[model samples]
Target chain A: MRSYKDIHNILLDRIKGGEWEPGALVPSEADLAREFGCTRVTVNRAMQALADSGLIERRRKAGTRVVQRMTRNAVFEIQLVRHEIEQRGGTYKYLLISRSEEKPPQKVRAEMGLSGDNALLHVISLHFADGAPYQLEDRWISLDTVTQARREPFDAISPNEWLLREIPYTNAEHVFRASRAEPMDAEFLNLGEGEPVFVIERTTWLSDAAVTHVRLVHPADSFRLVTRDQHGTAL
Target chain B: MRSYKDIHNILLDRIKGGEWEPGALVPSEADLAREFGCTRVTVNRAMQALADSGLIERRRKAGTRVVQRMTRNAVFEIQLVRHEIEQRGGTYKYLLISRSEEKPPQKVRAEMGLSGDNALLHVISLHFADGAPYQLEDRWISLDTVTQARREPFDAISPNEWLLREIPYTNAEHVFRASRAEPMDAEFLNLGEGEPVFVIERTTWLSDAAVTHVRLVHPADSFRLVTRDQHGTAL
Candidate 1:
């Protein structure tokens, strides 16, 4: 008596051996059961297992055929600057370069979905790992949504840390790109004027209200984002 | 007269207003119930909502306090080259540069966790969008695990597409970085020598057996990877 696992492995071998080409239909459960001297339920279980692994597709009456184009997903996590540095065995330091309440640039307002001439709290900060310039953070916090930000002094703690403790966002978007360092970014990150830099732009919202928008710039050679998936589960 | 949501917002305002600083314990449920003229259960529900959104921490005896460090998550999807190009409104094209079976380099072997003198199928290909070079794909398929790849000539279709349709991987790892293009990558990607390039390295396995490892390179100005999250759900 062959277990479903046995049938699964046997069918997997046959598929990998090219006995059935991609998009080609395989034997139905009833026929497979008869050939293997097993019940149709056992054969169905084996087929279902294969389908769940993305190897085959089963239609209502079209039977099972080898999948043609499989789409695999990869996930990357956005980490805090402090955590990223500490995880790399470096002492982390935060420096607040400037903080002011002003109307954000038109581009930023558009990105944050803010209409009207609303003033936001603008903050510029630098993060260091072992005394070396690591990340340049340009952040804007909405004073309308986070009213307490108006009275707070962000000199001691970074706005990122402050906001995380004070607000809970319901939506977030992240964009990762590579670009030549602008003058300000080059000056702060200690890089050549046109050196390549990796940039992450993030916008977060609390319900329908915008919370904050930030751009983190890092020296391209020193930073990378990694993520993994195991057993077909996204991480 | 306050509902859970009303209490939730009120508590949020007090926290944001710094009435209770981060790491500071707030009043207990009974106390908050008395203050808000609500049942303890209602207050508890409001507190639970705040905790669920990562705003506060509730301990058995330590009580609830504003959260100190909130770690957010971002997810990036690894898409097929053809699909990526098409999604950008360009005509996608694939060209096979070379294909051969050879012993992979030590670094690649280490990355794949292969410990023996194994010969793998190596493929070099270029992807074009709207008649311009878009990406360079350097891939190695373990002939030991993906035995059918040994006979498949990847001239008509990319090895990525062929393998996805033919095999199902149980695990995958992706690493994203920015690097200066090497000589071969420079030539294939049509970039100046040592120009910045965005790179993605991926390795996939079937169960515990390694199947393929690939490196994809693109011009820094042409490509980026974006991801999003909504309502606190990772996408």
Candidate 2:
């Protein structure tokens, strides 16, 4: 018997192959079931998978249609520094330049939604790929959320990898932009002052409580963010 | 009566609420069905939705578990330039700087996988938001894929919006990076030479044929890409 997964693949092929075409309302589940010589449940399962993948639009009353103006989504699973480097066949190294419990700056506080008298565990580190500077990391962990981080030895483990193992977060926001390398960034990344740098600011939350804020900087020529959709090939 | 969506919400709350916690194996579908007074199919539907949303991971033998290292995804609906500006309360304007049918540069040909003797429709345009230069777009459309574009009037409509309406593509790749504005870019964007510029290179494909390649450059301080997860508040 043809499984629902087979039907799902067939439907995806039709969408990508332009056989069904965009903005075309798909036949009802019952019709699909009859065509495939399967039950309505099997066809529904395939349709649901397509809908979840953002390939089709489904309505309770209006039925399902291929998205008119296809909005492609690039989904990326944020990975660890070590894993990211190792996956590219480069040896990974970590260096902790500074660690202290101090009051965050106004920008950090604003991003984390912290008010007066709030202090965070601020840590600055450098990550290396194949003995070259890869990323400059400036991170702040909420003392209220990860209390154990106060005494944690960051030299042995980067705060990012440590927190991933210790605390679980439910929400996050990522902002991507380009910036000129400041003096401090130039020194750390071994780049000239005013060189272009790719920047990413991530704020993670544990439900309603803000957990950590991190700023990662990379040499413009060295790093880029790529996202790929599963329905098609990525180049 | 409670539906699969109800079960999905309840399970998500438990995961995000820390009741189940990360890396914790969830109850089997049979158990969940019994508790919800429903069939295994209903519980399966809820579980499938959770897995699709990256809230949970499933394995045949190990069963389902709250993801240990939470990786979030940001989905963006690529919209028209006019809509993007109008939605932000800015008047949209378009200027076609240049349009010609010519041999594409080597880099573009390489990116598009085009061979010798093949020419493309090359277009350069500026998108303005509220009388300010918002984005500088350099685009190339494969004549083989979009033969109708040769005679199109780009002065009235932007090529990006035009292609989206004319041709439906199946695959795309987006590369986001930072660079210093060159002299030409500085003049076009009204920015100081060597200032940081946010660059996005997008290549779209239809089935196995490459359709278009575009590079969009924006002032770093003026634009940023924001991605948010569906389950949480957008910050």
Candidate 3:
């Protein structure tokens, strides 16, 4: 006999296949049980799981309905720069501007939950797509966690790409905001000072251990971060 | 008899409880089955579910381990303005600046996938948080979907809130970007022109019926949209 998981998959396929249009009422548990030759309890389990995933809506009077594909919230992938550029059929390039061992700035220290006098790897790099500046990355790495990162030549590979291969992180935090381009950012990203820019700040951790903190800036009109559904609809 | 889902929940509790830290290898399926008093197949099913959710990484020779929490993507809620302000312990105020029926601009019409000559209800409103301008809202409502909206007084309730209560929309598309504050937006948001602004554009639909399109703009320093995991970590 097929389990509830199987039933769940079947129903999910139906939804993904557009078998039931959004907002259309689906069969009740009893009806579904009869159709699948299963107990109502099994059908209920399947339906409940669907509801939890926001694929369906159930009410006492309304029964079950395929949820109108609402503007969905999607977890977007933190894509790799090389992959993003390559996917767009552009030549990808990386430039390591500077690398130094220095005390982290106050804000970086606060975000990493570090106190005074802690040394960190401060690195700045530029990523290009089709020979045009794509993003400017400013990063700080925890020297305590990945000690070997201090010696690796970052000119060959971006710090982010290198860290991913060397250390494994278990948690990450990301912040998205808008900012006017500073003079330094303007020089790197080739945008005018004070132009609107999309800023992404990320902190990764290995359990409770802070691994790295990075800030990426992209020119507003040139780049956009998108989240979407399986049907390619913006979510 | 307990189902695989019960085993799944038990394992999930262990992960949440920090019994196995991120990047720690989990016990094999056979061992898990022995501990839980279940078949290995049941344990496998539970493990598979966890892997699907990005909680665990499974490899052929290396075995399963807690996934390094990479930069996570999250779905952001298109929250109500009143709820947001009230939650933040501020007074919520709304002002209807203008209301008219007119043909949408080319860009707006293109986004809604509408052709020429269709009249939409255009509305401009400001949301205030504690007597300060919180956001500027420019909206276009499709007259075909909600005919009664033409006569409803918007002075009392914002169009977004009203749509949520009255209409049964199933889908929405959202675009988040950064833009320079235009002259009108600078005046409305109490910011200097050319300052950065976070902009969110959303299009809501009832199945195939386009319902509304709205653009919300907030001053860069005053507002930010955040996405996070349940643990309050940014995702």
DockQ of each: 0.34, 0.50, 0.31
Question: lDDT ranking from best to worst?
Answer: 2, 1, 3
* Model 2 CAPRI rating: medium
TM-score of chain B of each: 0.74, 0.93, 0.77
Candidate 2 residue runs with Cα over 4 Å from true position: A13-22, A230-235, B17-25, B35-37, B69-71, B115-117, B230-235
- TM-score of decoy 1: 0.75
Model 3: lDDT of residue A3: 85
lDDT of 3 by residue, B1-235 (tens): 6588888778776775568777889999999898888899889878877775667889987999987754434556556888878878999999998999999999999888887678999999999999999899999999998898999879999997887656755466777788889898999999999889998888877667788999999988878766644322222
Candidate 2 chain A least-lDDT 10 residues: A226-235
Task: Give each model's whole-structure lDDT.
Answer: 0.83, 0.85, 0.80
Best by TM-score: 2
Each candidate's TM vs. the true structure? 0.75, 0.90, 0.78
Q: Best-fitting candidate, measured by lDDT?
A: 2
lDDT of 1: 0.83
Model 2, span B1-235: residue lDDT tens: 6699899989988976679988899999999999999999899988887886677899987899988754566665567778888988999999999999889889999988877758798899999999999899999999898889988979989998888877877677788899889887898999999899999999988877889999999988888887765553211
- Error (Å) of candidate 1 at residue A213 is 1.1
Q: Which residue pairs show backbone clashes in model 2?
A: none
